[model samples]
Target: MPELKLAIDAMGGDNGPSVVIEALINSLKQDTTTQFVVVGDEAILSSLFSQFELSDHPQVTLVHAEQVVEMTDKPGATMRQKPQSSMRVALDMHAHGEVDGVVSGGNTGALMAQAYFILKPIPGVLRPALMAALPNMTGGRSYLLDLGANPSCDSETLFQFGVMGSVAARVLESDKNVSVALLNMGEEELKGNDEVRNAAQLLGQSEHVNYIGFIEGNHLFSGRADVIVCDGFVGNIALKSCEGLATLIIDELKASLTSHWLYSWFFKFLQKRTKKSWQRLKPDHYNGASLIGLRGVVVKSHGSANATAFESAISHAIKEASHRLPEKIQDRVESVLLEQH
Candidate 1:
């Protein structure tokens, strides 16, 4: 627990600064060694601080931002019109080495755009990809990348994602025997369109990656691979679809258990056990997607994430920053590219 510093975009997210402020309290409790610079409007943050009774938290500081990027804001427009935005300011802080990492539950497009412009990509990385750990059947997790960073990536870009993701899995998962797989329509060599097949070929030829062939979306949690690669277009849809389905199932189970005539001690007991079991796989509650392959660490939390979940995003930033992930990815990518040449 070294004295780590991170910047927070306090005014992002659908829940706005209130959730970020509460999350800061929770995060501070979880990691005493981390210092936070919460960026947003000064007066509003001050009011929230007073309300939370965290106005005197020595580890937390406030930085004022003049503009707030809305969920509806276009990335290009936001960049030009909202130069002083909380998202931009937080990234600026990270770029300038004022903070080791940044956490934001902001406009995904805007945040990604700002992050790419401010932090830039590692030298050999074609483009920065977003990666998050998803629960797998073996009770372990796999890292999925290109979570909407580049919705339409080329063969080479997809290939680079595989290399980047493989390095990331090894570093973040702390597992040297990590496996990489391309998400496809089928697990055959001839499956998928040109880019996917080409990327698979690239990964297969690379000694740097442990190419495990293709993995269909259904086997995402089967522990077939430790690192799953896909273009952002497919990855985003798959991730959200899975999340939506999980939420639906959990809600339905709760409703049925509470409303049924068999709602007795037995039913209550089942619900309790089920909830505990499902808590570990709850994607919405504590998921944080990191924008990887960038020069600095930037974690993107769901815009609707609660205090606990956002707190997890803060921890995610700390972990990646502490690991010097960007540098590691750079080294891996450089080696992989040189081998190709």
Candidate 2:
């Protein structure tokens, strides 16, 4: 097996290196073969090391990064002005072939902007979009594209999302017929305005995409569609709304059930048995979203991701990198573009 080196941004998330370090430890504890290059200020990492005990395993390395880019800073400005920032440092490692993959729990916009500019996309891909897996009860999970990449996309972009998403679906589940659908207000042809109509036509005629026709908001979680395509504006709303509803449900159950004496006692018992399972189901645990179409794997995690989330993100990146998803995506996109030509 070729040695895989991962560059992680230690100071990108809300909890800074604390959670990121915790996550790295979690992953490293499980497997010693995986090596990590954590990029951040040397002093802060040194201080935190004394607090948390890293195993005697010597696979982890720390790369000194003097600058830190906040989530609020402009991507272009930060890249040009603060070249040595944590985000830039990690990306530079990948650009210069020092690392095979990069992962960050940081500003989504800046991550996307910096990656697109620095790493660039595969040969045939026009744009890079975000791909996330939504938990589904019936099957393993469903993929939704353009999660937060472009607020507004054209018909061509929508078609591209379908192709990308379908490719992901195939990679995730072999022999499973991947169904693609355009997210819209209604299933009818005349439902949405011009954008929906044009996108629908493009998807409907796509040879690369499964192109199952239009799907409404309600069908997203119904497990009817394996790959859902939409603009980032709509996709972001759907993703956030899904997370919000899941959180609300969990909160309401805890609040209402714990109030009663009998229920409270049972809840305590249940918590002891099911706490780990419940925590695993939380949306934050799966923080990373692969910025699809890049020549290399670039995973973006939530800004507020915790240690467990960061670990999961890193593991996910390793899985994707090992699979060489970028190369697979290149083949699929190039084939589709050739047929178009």
Residue range 262-321, candidate 1, lDDT tens digits: 765667788588887778777654478999989999999998899888988888888888
TM-score of 2: 0.90
Top model number, lDDT: 1
Would you list the C-alpha lDDT of every candidate in the order shown?
Answer: 0.88, 0.82
Q: What is the lDDT of residue 217 in candidate 2?
A: 87
TM-score per candidate, in order?
Answer: 0.94, 0.90
Model 2 poorest 10 in a row by lDDT: 48-57
lDDT of 2: 0.82
Pairs of residues at least 3 apart in sequence or in different chains that clash in candidate 2: none
Which candidate wins on TM-score? 1
